[model samples]
Target: MDNYARLKQVWIAVIYLLLLAIIIPWYWPEEDVRQFYGFPIWALLSLSGLFLTSCFTAWVCLGREVTKE
Candidate 1:
């Protein structure tokens, strides 16, 4: 696979794992959920990364199978 293809695969895998983490609860000490810039830590990071990866995958797929005139 070419560089773009490899990178795309890595990103797709990472996003899938992140989604799994988000959905499945894990062990965490009871504490107030901290907010950074008014965003929850887990929500901010996981969701943002998930969105970024999705957009990137879409862009790559668009280039792979279609052309714009």
Candidate 2:
């Protein structure tokens, strides 16, 4: 792999780490009870993060070039 490819992978990994952090509800307050669209706010936020991660992964996978070695 080249330097550019390594850098790209590092950036992708950072994004994924951010998504993972968002998906985890460790930051939400335990006693707070907020709701949105009938679901808990934290739950919705986690779900949204998950959806975004999925979309990002799909975009990356589908948009990547195919190389024959």
Candidate 3:
């Protein structure tokens, strides 16, 4: 993959992390809603999103190579 495309992926990773970080902290502590499998519902959802996004990013970054035109 070209360096430019790789750089874009780094930006994407940063954006995703920033978004998740902002949202998880903002939403997790509100209302004290019950726990799912030992975690608040919001926390669980955030965690799931993080995990899935990681898997997807790895799949996109490693499973396929981007070529410059």
Candidate 1 residue spans exceeding 4 A from truth: 1-32, 65-69
Model 3 earns a TM-score of: 0.49
Candidate 3, position 26, lDDT: 70
For candidate 2, the per-residue lDDT at 32 reads: 78
Which is superior by lDDT, 1 or 3? 3
Consecutive 10-residue window with the lowest summed lDDT within model 1:
23-32
What tens digits encode model 3's per-residue C-alpha lDDT throughout 1-69? 999979988988787777577446674556687887787777777777778777767866797767799
lDDT of 2 by residue, 1-69 (tens): 999999999999999999999999999999979998889999999999999999999999999999899
The alpha-carbon RMSD values of the candidates against the true structure, listed in the order shown, are 5.0, 1.2, 5.0
Task: Quote model 1's TM-score.
Answer: 0.45
Question: What ranking emerges by TM-score with the best candidate at the front?
Answer: 2, 3, 1
Give the clashing pairs for model 1. Answer: none
Which stretch of 10 consecutive residues in model 2 shows the poorest summed lDDT? 31-40
Q: What lDDT tens digits, residue by residue, belong to model 1 across residues 1-69?
A: 899979978987887677667644364335758889997676666677677667766876676765589
Q: Estimate candidate 3's RMSD in Å.
A: 5.0
lDDT, candidate 1, equals 0.69
Q: Of the pair 2 and 3, which is ahead by TM-score? A: 2
List candidate 2 segments past 4 Å from native.
none
